[model samples]
Structure formats: C-alpha cells, structure tokens
Target: RESNNAMQMVEGLGEDDDLLRVAQELPEPSDLLESDDDAPIIRLINAVLTSAVKENASDIHIEPYENRLVIRFRVDGVLKEVLQSRRAVAPLVVSRIKVMSKLDIAEKRLPQDGRISLRVAGRAVDVRVSTMPSGHGERVVLRLLDKHAGRLDLSHLGMDARTQATMDALIHKPHGIILVTGPTGSGKTTTLYAALERINDNTRNIMTVEDPIEYYIDGIGQSQVNTKVEMTFARGLRAILRQDPDVVMVGEIRDLETAEIAVQASLTGHLVLSTLHTNTAVGAVTRLRDMGVEPFLLSSSLIGVLAQRLVRLLDPATKEAYRASDYECSVLGVDPADPPTLYRVPDGLSAGEGYRGRTGIYELVPIDDSIRTMIHDGAGEHELERYARTLSPSIRDDGLRKVLAGDTTLEEVLRVTRGD
Candidate 1:
C-alpha cells in the first residue's frame, strides 16, 4: 500500500522525463516568470497541493539536495517524505513556486516570504510560502491554512468540561489580557481564533494586528503587519487601539513595547488576546517580566494563561489495551494498585510514528485574587507554578488525563510535553 501511494505521488508530479521535456519547452525567460495555466509544472504543483489538502497536511516542503529533489508533507505535526524527483528539476519547481507566489524568482540569493490563496477540492486554503537559499538549490516551504479547520469552537478544542468552562469565562470577560502560550505549530493561533469566534456577535468591534492574517472571518477587522512600510506589531496595535475596538488580538507579543502596549490596552478597557512562546503557563509571567513589563501591570491586566501542546491521537482501530506500570500510574496521579487501562500505538510501532490525527493537551490557568497577589508581589515561576497547580492541571497532567481516558498514548503526551 505504501509503495502504491508513493507511485501515485510520483505520477502526480510526473516522471523526470516529463519534467525535463516540459522544462525545455518553456517560453524562454518571460513565460517562466508568469504562471502558465496549461504548464506541466503548474499541474504538478497543483497536484501536490491538492494531495496535501486532502490528506490534511499542515505544510509542504520542497527540498533539493545534491542527489535529488524531495517533496515532503507535514501531516498531524509530523513531516514525511512523499516524493522525490530528478536533481536537475529543482530549479524549475522552485521557480514555478516563486512565480505562483508572486515573489522575485530571479532573486535566489535572499530569503523571501509570500502567500497563495487558492481553492482545492472546493475548500479554501491559504498557503504561506517561504523560500531560502541552499547549497543544492532554493528550498521552499508552504504552510497550509485550512479555513474549515480554523473554525473550531472552544468545545471542540479537546478541553475538558472544567477547562472549557474556565476558557469560556475568561474569553467573555469585559476587560483584561488572556494569553495563549505555546511554541510555534502548537495551535496557539487556532485557540485565539476560536476565542474570537466565540465572542464575535457583530455588536462588538473586534480588531486584530497579525504578522500575517492566517484565516479570514467576517465582522472582524484584521490588519497585517508590513515592516517594509514601518508597520509592526507594536505600531499596528497602537493604531488598533485608536479604532475604538472592544476587543484586540495581537498575533504575538515579541518586544517590551508590544507587551507594554498590550498591557495598557487591557487596562484602558479593551479585552486583549495574544500569544507568548513559553513552555508552561507560569513561564508566561516570567517571560513578560523579563520583557520589562511591570509585575503590577502584568498582575492587573492578566486574567488567564492557557499553555497547550498537540499530541497525536491513537488509531482506535489499531490501538490495543495495556496495563500501566507503577511509574506511569504515579505520574498519572493514580495509585499503582488501581492502575487504569492504558492504550498505545500498537506494540511494534516505532517511536515518532503517528497513529491518527492530533488533538490538544492544555493547561488553563485562570489568575484569581491570590495568584494575582502573588504576581503583583513579583513571585517567581516556581512559586506561581506551585500556586497554579492548586487551581488547574499542568499541561503534562492534562495530557496524562487524556492518556487515562484513552484519547492518546502516554508516549505521545510525553513526547510533546518533554520540556515539562
């Protein structure tokens, strides 16, 4: 079956002879700069894109090495090699992608970022294209943003009843900052979008300043940062505040200026939503403090912080029930004598291999009066974390809960929450 799938992918990209023949038949220099609707390269690229969307891939990688050109797809947060073609065809494929994204195909020396908005299988997809120079050739990556996937509600975000209730209350709060902290590709943007969707009633003026708007939703004013034109997160956020926005979503708080602006915005009256690159919920406070935000300001403006990670779910058809070891039971906070029935991704399966799609494991920390007091007093991360444990489960604990409930494997949870 795997070989058949590979053959299909190869056929989709066409054989090397077909690629070479089409490359030579191209219309000199000018046609190469334009997207030819009937071109073989166009069909090959489209086929790859269509397959990616159909397979629910998050990113498409076109990498060229000394021996061959490789195409990979990141599905369920794992990259898999899907196809390989002739090394000589690397330039043609890279140039075609650059042309399609409207980037300077001739400028192969520097990095470039662009976007492609297209429909595949009747579903709208927004592809963020990035190209970088390599020894063999230019390497390109396409980040796929499925509009349907972006519409996930909070209830469908793998949050338990209590966590969902906490999230609902936090997002509905009139004023204060609620942060979704996670590393890149950890579904931070999706969570923020879900919160915005929940509160978007057309009565409130919702506004956002994103590095690049990933998904489009009606009734919300979305602005993209244009650094070339002096528009950055801080600058765009400043402009958003003046627009009479009831709620503001900053894609990320990267600098002290942006963090201060977000804090001030929340203090002034608008509810603020943003993300931070942190390993845990408590670490977000320390990160902001390190960014020069006053502890008091952070305590006052912060309402909640949700730390999340994506873990691949087990394939129910293939998963087998097993017994948990003593250490596993201890980690899950269960007594060894009453170890729960656990499930794994089959016995012979190798590590880093996925069983099915991915789901979120989250730590939702709602800052209460006591926690607020702790933060206002400049409490350390260890202290804050110790307090947070009393209110909600840590990210790893949440993952373990999913493990106990048979949602995912213990290994999958530990894989994502290794830092914790």
Candidate 2:
C-alpha cells in the first residue's frame, strides 16, 4: 500500500515532460524580447504552473539575485531551489506572471498582488501572485490552491479519538463560539472550515465574512470583506448576524469590534466559528480580553478552542520503529524502553504517497463549568493552560502518538510545534 501511494505521487510526471522541458530549457524571456506576440509567454506560464502542480508544491517562487535567477518550490513547509537561469531574463518572466494575475505589467517599481486561474493536467488551479521589489530585481511568489488537495472531513483531520469526540460535541452546540488558534500557516483555517462543512446540512442558514474567501463551500453564504468600501470584519459580521444565519464563521477575530460581535452573536443562539492568532488554546482567551472583550461576555459565549499545527505524515514505506531517547520520552511522557518513536528517512520513497500530505496535531480546550469560572474570574494564560490539561491532551501528547504509530516522526512534530 505504501509503494502504491508513492507511485501515485509520481504517476503523472510523464505527461508533464513537455511542460517541464519548455520551462527548464527555454532561454531567458529577455532573449525573445524582439517579438511582441504572447504565445511563448503563455507557454512559459503554463510550464511553470504545470511543474509546480505535478510536484505537489504549495507555492512557487522566482527570485532574482545579483548574478542569476533561482526557481524554488515550497513543499511540506520547506523551500527547495529547483531551477536556475540567467538574471537578465527574470524581470520579463515576472511580467508575464503579472499579466496572468491581471496586475500592472508596466509598473515594476511597486509591489502588487493578484490572483489567476490556470488549467494544469486538465484541472483548474488557483494561483495567488505576490510580487515585491528587491535590491536586484522583482521577486515573484505564487501560492497554489488545488481544489482536490484534500477532503474536508472532521474525522479525517488527524485528531486523536478523544479530541475528535470533544470537537463533535462542541460544534453541534446551537450557540457559543468555537475558536481555532494558531500562528499564520498553522492549518487553523482548515480545521475551522472542516467544522463548518460538517455542520452544514442545509438545515441552517450559514454565512461567513472572510478577508478574501479562500474555499467555496456549497450551501453556505460566503462574503468577502473589502476594507476600502468599509466592509471590514467587524462591520461585515454585524451585517451577517442580521441575515439570520444559524451558523456564522468570521474568517478571523482581528480586532476588538469583530471579537465583540462574534461573542455577542454566540450569546444570541448563533454558532460562531472563527480563527485567532495565538500560540496556545488558552492564549486565545487572553487575546480576546486584551482586545477589551469583557470577561463575563466572553465566558458566557465560549464553547471551546482548538490549537493546531500541520505536521507532515511519514512515508510508511520507509518508517522504522526506534527506541526513544531520554529527552524524547520526557517530551512524550512515555517510557524509553518502549518503541515510542517512529523515525522515517528524510528523503521519502515518493513525493505524494510517502510524505505527500499533512494532518492536524491538536490541543483542544472544551469550556466546561470550571473553565468558564476561570474565564469569568480573569485567569492568566498559564492558569488556564494548567486547568485545561486535566481535561484534554496537549498538542505534544497527540503528536507523539502519531510518532509511536508510524504516522509521523518526532522531529516533524517538534518542528511544527515550534519545538515545544
């Protein structure tokens, strides 16, 4: 089964030979500057995107240095440089990308951001383009959004059985807030969105206010926030509440007004799902209080908080059981004589199958009576953490189990946990 999965990861590379050849072998776009036609440019764009998708890359980066141009891809949260070309041609290549994203090709001095859709391997792939001015030239980064990348199932999110059960109970509550807390790129959005998808049975009015809508879910009324026109998170959320949504997802609680509105909505029989930028589940409560949300109001409307990080799954084909070190056992709170860790080869057998995808390692805090009392009394983050630990497993504990089960490595878990 492991080998079969690895095979699927590299299965379609043969079909991308044409596109990769054009992208890798073609001379600098500057060399073809004499022609005004855009066919070659379009082909170049296709090649870059096709290679990126085939490699299961999350983002593609084109960087220009003093003497050369470097093409890199970010896979499994690490950036690896894959291609190199002449420095003179990098600017023209970036301009072609700007064209696709509908950004101003003529304005290279200023930073710009835009999005574009491309057909790769007969599928639509969304690319978010961000270009910035640099010392040598402009740098281009494209975030690839694949529609079929993963299924939005709550049970399949890689939580421990207990955490999954706790989540199932909280999300079904008719009111109160469920917040997923993590730093940027820690997979908070995926977890919250999965919860929304799970409860979205077309029996309730669902609505969301996102800065920019990332995923499209059927039967949910999604709105994008445009600050220029005064459609900010706080204002938009207030509007959403008026629309009679049974469930509401605010992309993020970015400010005081938004946090207040979401908490108030939760008190009024609306299930509010939102994300917060914090390191721990307990930290979310302090974060809200720091934004001036009253403790009583917050405690009354809070259901639970999920603190999560995305860790790469090991290639089962290459994973091997190993004795845990003293430090490892201490971190996981397990015996060293036991096979407490599953170590895998850094270079997996294949791209997609072995370490092809990621799963959530989480620490969840379900706000019970005791937790609510602590919140109302204005407890500190550490006190909340200490209290929550008795009810739910820490993120580190959940991650170590995956290590013991050959699902991931201890080092991968530590890396995503910020070395906790």
Candidate 3:
C-alpha cells in the first residue's frame, strides 16, 4: 500500500509540475526591490501583505540573519517559511515594515510597536506590528486582523459532547466570573468570543474591554485599551461598570487590580468573562488565589474555568503524515477498539490534504456546589484536578474518544493536550 501510494504521489507531481513552478516562482518582497530606488521595497511589502490577505494568513514573521532574510506565515497555528531573500535585501525589508507601521526606523537596539491598515482585495485589514532586537538582527512580527472572520459558534470550537454540555451549563449562569485560561495562540480569545456570542441579546448590555478589539459584534459595546493614555484594563473596567452592563468581557486579567475588578463585577449584578494564563482549568483558581484574590470571593463569584491549547492536526488525506506514537496513545488512555488518529486541522486553515487548520482541545471546570465548597475551604489546584478526574469521564479521555470517533484528529488533540 505504501509503495503504491508513493508511486501515485510521484505521478500526481509529474502532472502538476506547471502549477508547482508558478507557486514556487511567486516573487518574495526582496526580489522586487531595486538596489538604489526604495519605492520598490514599499511596493514589494504591500504586495507581500496583499498576498497574505489573499492566502488568509493570520500572522507574518520577518527574521533577519547574517546572510539571509526568512519570511514566515502562521496559518491556523502552524508557522511555515514562505520566502527567503539575499543578505543584501534584509535591511530594506525591515525598514519597509518599520516605515509602514510608523515605528522608529533608525532605532534597532530597542523594541518598538505600531499598527497600520491596508485594503486588499477591496477588504480592509488591520495589521499590528511589533519589533524586538534579536541576536542575529531585529525580529518583526505582524498580527493580521481580518474583521470579516467574526465570532464563531460555540459548537464549532471542537468541544466533545460532554465538555460542551458542561460549558453550556456554566455559561447560562446569570452572574459569576468565567475564566478561559490558556497560553498565547491557544484560541483563548476565540473561546471567550463564542461564549459572549451566546449571551448577547437585545435585553442585555454586553461590554468588552480589549487591548485592541480583534473582532467586532453588532450588539456588544467594545472598548480598546490605550495604556499610553492611561486607559488600562482596571480603569476600563471601572468605566464599563458605570454603564450598567449585564455581562462584561475583559480581554485578559493581567494584574491584581483587574482581577479584583472582575471579581467585584461578578459579585455585583454582572456576568464576567475573561482569559487567564494557565495550563489547565483547575490551575486558574490557584492562579487567582496566588494573585491575592480571597478564596471566599473566588468561591462565590467563580462560575467556571476553561483551559486550552493549540496543536497541529494530522493531514487525514496525506498518507505519509505523522501519527501519534504508541506512547501518546497510552497517555491519552486510548481504547483498543478505537485508536486516536490525526484527522482534522486547526481553525482558519486552507492547505494540505491531511491537515489545513488547527482545532482546540479544552478542559472545562464548572463550579458546582461541591466544587464551590472545596474552593471555600481553600482547596488547591491539585484538589480541583483530582475532583475533575473523579467525574464520570475525564476531559482528556472524552477528547480522545472524539478523536477516535473521527469528530476531530488525534494530532490536534495531542497538539493541544500534549497527551504524551
């Protein structure tokens, strides 16, 4: 079977050589620039960005080395190099981005940041640019924001049936704090946006405070944080509270002041949704407690916690795609009748047969009466994990079941869950 597959792939490649050549020949930004005239560099950068929008890339990375410039794009959650330029052209590319973003082009030793808006294919797109000094040279990262890719439904987030049910129950609560915890690029914003979408209605006033609002919803009031002007998360929350919102979404709880305000908002008449940096749902409680939040306040105001991660999916259509090793299967407690397989890709993807996008694997902890009592008694993160494990079936176990059932891919599960 493997030999036949390889022969077929070779034949297919032979038939598509022209298409492959065109794709390979797509010019890099540096290739379009002239040695003396700088206009080409600007045009080239715009062209690259235009291509990115056309290709639906979420982020672009420009890394400069001693002898070359490497350009990479993050689609879904995977970073893949798209172009390489000669050493002579690296400086021009970097300066082009800095100038477009309105950063200090002359300063290379320090970090700088700015944003720009460009219209590609008749659609407006926002790009957030940040540059930091690296060992080889300056590293620039551009986060692409497409307003059209609005909030998604909760059911579309790849949660298993049991986990989805638990999450739904928690979000239906009228007043409490729900924390979605995960590292960066783990779909924290997407998950919270799904929850907010569910609760938004004509009867309720929903307000959100984000550093720079990523997505806009029609009925919700969104505020952007401007730290340069002293409009921060804490201050924003205070202002949002005065507006008598029934539900609030804080982009992230980064400090004690914001955490305290979020808790207080929940204790009052509002339901608060926010994100935290933690590895698991249970860890969220411990993190809050460690951040100086009173246990009693947490026990009362906390509704639920969701911890998630992003992982690569196995391309189901790619015969030679990597599979979960036996060790990974064991860690996820895979059943013999139905083994885990890499099947589906992540969100916002379009490429490769086996995997084109990434999916989110989440563990949810809803604060039931018993769990609330545990929190009230100062039960640590371990206690919450233990209790979560004692439930009928675990999130990890159930997630593996979904992989085996072909609802999602094991590659995605392991990517986010780190099963082994």
What are the Cα lDDT values of the candidates? 0.86, 0.81, 0.75
How would you encode candidate 3's per-residue C-alpha lDDT over 239-352 as one tens digit per residue?
Answer: 999998998999999999999999999998789999998877788888989999999999999988887766444555543423566776676665535544544454455554
- Among the numbered candidates, top lDDT falls to 1
- Give one digit per residue, the lDDT tens place, for model 2 in 1-420: 212321232333346456546666665555578777655555665666777787788899999999998888888777877777778768778887776677898887999988775556766566778999999999999998766534778888898778898999999999999999988888787787788888889899999999677777888899998876998999899999899899999999988988988988998899999999988889899999999999999999999999988888776665666677888777777776673545775554544345756888899999999999999999988899899999887887788788878788787888877744
User: 315-353, model 1: which lDDT tens digit per residue?
Assistant: 888888999999998878889998899997766876445
Candidate 1 clash total? 0
Question: For all candidates, what are the clash counts?
Answer: 0, 0, 10
The C-alpha TM-scores of every prediction are: 0.90, 0.91, 0.81
Ranking by TM-score: 2, 1, 3
> Candidate 3, TM-score vs. the true structure?
0.81
**Which residue segments of model 2 deviate by more than 4 Å?**
1-14, 18-20, 28-30, 337-341, 346-354
Against the true structure, candidate 3 has what lDDT? 0.75
